[model samples]
Target: MFMVGRESEAFKHCTPIPILGVACYAFGLHLLKTCGIMRSIARADLDFSYITSRLAVMSQPAEGLVESAYRNHAEDVRALLEGRHKGHYTVYNLSGRRSGALSLHSGDATHMSGGNVVDCPGWKSHRAPPLSALYTLCEVMYDFLEADPKNICIAQCMDGKASSATLVCAFLMFVNMFPRPEDAAQMFAVKRTPPGLQPSEM
Candidate 1:
């Protein structure tokens, strides 16, 4: 599911501006972050860390899921460039990579330069990443958000269920938005889908 979180506050500023959350599935899209003949507060997919093969895809209702992936990836940036989201947005990304992302950004600067995006190589699907690695990810996230409040960070994992969700929760706690990880987890559960965290995630 593609969950777009609004400008979350950090004290008085909108630091950690907007955290865009989505799952991994957009295999056909070759997304490149372009801004104003370009983009703004871009709402494209954050990351795709699948096994980089057909086995990564779901076995049932494959067409619908794939189509949704294609549509979301294609439409989001088009909407932004079309002036639908008029605000100037510097989007960052915080997620993991399995080997590396496939068609998602094989030719884009986001992949090549690692711009505002931070890849957590310790992470895989269904299970959460190492706690130490999570701390590092949160630090990078805080630095990114602190640099500019208007900057939005996008995050994702295989399905935004385990690693992705935990990262969000950890960021919330790390930034003191929530006093505890459990509090952040509760908030994530309320905002996103029901299965916000798997057992391992907790």
Candidate 2:
């Protein structure tokens, strides 16, 4: 629970803010800003489960559902639930060191775009990674979202910056139905200041 990019000074305005510099301080600030609790004695703890629950409460899907499936081989997954339209609990991991699953199901006919589902005819785009690669990732993402639309999807890389952001932005545009990659990027930037723009490797 490292507060990767929260500058300590950001919370200076909050009275009686913790000087301990713990990651939970950021969560407190967020809660204070959104929940409007001054003299904030009882701090709210936000772990993965808390976030997942909050999203469910707000009718928002969980994060990382899409990226998890994309990172693994599809056939390796063991779908906990299966439907003609989609499948769920798709667990897969090649190395056996760490295993993961997509918790949702979607109909087979639906194509994922921008963090949402769409039809083939409507899936139009000219971008890097090519359609084949994009479709494969979309299928994985769709499975997770379909299983539980309110589930959160998570992704990570060594740096936990651009690579993670790329996958997230991809899901935002492809499955979440975000209109533009730039829009997705801006959304991420709000949470964390992004590094300098770099040319796409592809």
Candidate 3:
């Protein structure tokens, strides 16, 4: 009677329970992948050490400060460029004005080399010079992407999270329409924050 009871119990437990368990496991994985919260957590985990090291370098500015800063933060910048992390970043002004001039010249030369110079449309549509500057910057980034989509990731750092969010959204939209979302995601970290929250809230 005990053996008979044990056999019945085993038969009852073996049928739908395993199937339901497998289904539940698959569903949980799907939720995790689709929700993206875990991905963000993983990214933050991977970036924390590098970010802290960078912050430390930023604190010190005595003797070879520029070189030391670059040595410390160069990998972070590269990761950003490679789209492994999300943030707008630039090199610390290493050679001062000379470096700035060189970068400006390089950007200008790249634009001119395209051979399709167009006159700047008047800024009468916008009142502020900063607005005009913003337009110009957008045009430059668009042109750069048009010329070599694979080589560049454009980001701006005004209003911190809002600017980053806008840029990321635009990039994702463009990537979805023209090229590929996975490719764009690989090239730029998408900003993630709950809606209606300011950067300070984070």
Best by lDDT: 1
- Residue ranges of candidate 2 with Cα displaced over 4 Å: 1-131, 195-197
Give the runs in model 3 whose Cα sits over 4 Å from its true position. Answer: 1-72, 79-129, 156-160, 166-191, 194-202
Model 1: per-residue Cα lDDT over 1-202, one tens digit each = 2222333232213122222322211111101112232221344352221211100111011124464654334234324323432232222222343213222323221232222223446566667767787777666554444444233444544454466567666666554444455656655554444445676676
Question: What TM-score would every model get versus the actual structure?
Answer: 0.50, 0.37, 0.31
**Model with the higher TM-score, candidate 1 or 2:** 1
Whole-model lDDT per candidate: 0.38, 0.32, 0.27
Q: Which stretch of 10 consecutive residues in model 2 shows the poorest summed lDDT? A: 51-60
The model with the greatest TM-score is: 1
Report lDDT (Cα) of residue 128, candidate 3.
Answer: 24
lDDT of 3 by residue, 1-202 (tens): 0011111221222221223244333221221122223233223322221111111001111234464432323343344333532222222221112222113223331243321211222222112223444345444544443343122332322222233333333333332321332322222332233113232311
Q: Clashes in model 3: which pairs?
A: none
Full ranking by lDDT: 1, 2, 3
Model 2 / residue 28 / CA error / Å: 28
lDDT by residue for model 2 (104-129), tens: 33323333322222112222112233
